[model samples]
Target: MELLLVEDDERVSRFVRRGLEAEGYSVTAAQDGVAGLSRARAESYDVLILDVMLPGLSGRDVCRQLRKAEVSTPILMLTALDHTDDKVECLRGGADDYLTKPFDFEELLARLEALARRGRGFSSEPPAVLEVGNVRIDRQSMRVLLDGEPVELTAKEYQLLDLLLSSPGRVFSRTRILNKVWGYDSDPLTNVVDVYIRRLRGKMRWDRDTGWIRTIRSYGYRLDPTI
Candidate 1:
């Protein structure tokens, strides 16, 4: 995932950038709130980590401005303040989450993952590669392969596959899939899902022993890793 970190604290920013990069994320960092806000407005990122205290502008103001500009990216505020009021203020200013200084890196990572997944039906964290059975998907390159053989897919097909692979076995209802993947709710007259499912199965060469996309009768579909 592409992330923008807005922090004036050099030590903190470097720490986060290094950690996230090691975990396969593309990170761009800004040192001050104004610069950070400018970058956020001019570019698209999967997530933003903003420090509460910064030169020129406060993280709260940056978040508020981003929201005003209709930028829906998730914002995680980093603050040394630990009061309940501080947390409330961050949320009130349109921040999605906040981390107290001296916080556990693991916890911060978890929160980042959670915030990043808010609108997308992806794995909690941004993943470079996803694997199920012999099927492998390289998220960075948007390539799919089965047992080392490349598989070509249409744009929509690839998106559907990516959603399923995001969380194996997380049963996604037809309506949910329709909204998430198709960008709309399900319609009784539409058989688009069936058509895509059939296409996916055929393209993936699914068989009884390798049926990764399992139909949960009367409900929806799930990626069965066991299959």
Candidate 2:
């Protein structure tokens, strides 16, 4: 999932951006309201976390203008103040959810996920790591672990694992894997898939007992957690 955070406070923006990125969600940030609004307009994001207090445009105005402009991406307003009217105004202005400053990170993630799910009917899972058998992938930190120990992998290897781990059990054919991981499909004769699979198996220490990656004859590969 892609997210845009429009916050002015450098400390807060850095903290939230780092935290969100670690959770596996692609995140882009803008320091102030004008820049935030422009970015949100120019690109597509699954969710937008906007601070109520901003430099050029207020978060409320941004929300109103977004709705006015027909941008329906979910907006979760952040504020230091927790007033009754503040909550009312946030919703009234077209924001989807609200979170106060100094709030719990876990709670923030939960609300953000919920709002995103409501918007797109997709997983809102963040801060929580994705697990497959003994392999754990943290989307936020882009960290991968095997059996509680850190396992080093190349960027492409991690992306491939992330793709497989994101949707377990479903077979990802070589062509699909190539298109997704490499962002383009080469000639059908490439042996890239087999090579990466070997590297992943070697690094992950897969075996008949582990049975992490399953070869479906001539079809493709799937992550079989049952192993």
List lDDT for all candidates, in order: 0.85, 0.86
Candidate 1 lowest-lDDT run of ten: 119-128
Query: Candidate 1: what lDDT?
Result: 0.85
Q: How close is every model to the real structure, measured as TM-score? A: 0.57, 0.58
Evaluated with lDDT, which candidate comes out highest?
A: 2
How many angstroms is residue 81 displaced in model 2 relative to the true structure, after the best TM-score fit?
A: 0.8
* lDDT digits (tens) for residues 1-227 of candidate 2: 79999999999999988777655568999998999999989999999999999999999999999999999999999999899999999999999999989987667876887887888966555446888778889888889998899999999999898988877876777766777798765457888988998898899888744668888778678887763
* C-alpha root-mean-square deviation, each candidate: 14.2, 13.6
Candidate 2: the clashing residue pairs are 21-140, 22-139, 22-140, 22-141, 23-139, 23-140, 24-139, 24-140
Which digits, one per residue and each the tens of the lDDT, describe model 1 over residues 1-76?
Answer: 7999988888888898986775457899999988999999999898999999999999999999999999999999
Query: Which number leads on TM-score?
Result: 2
Worst 10 residues of 2 by lDDT: 121-130
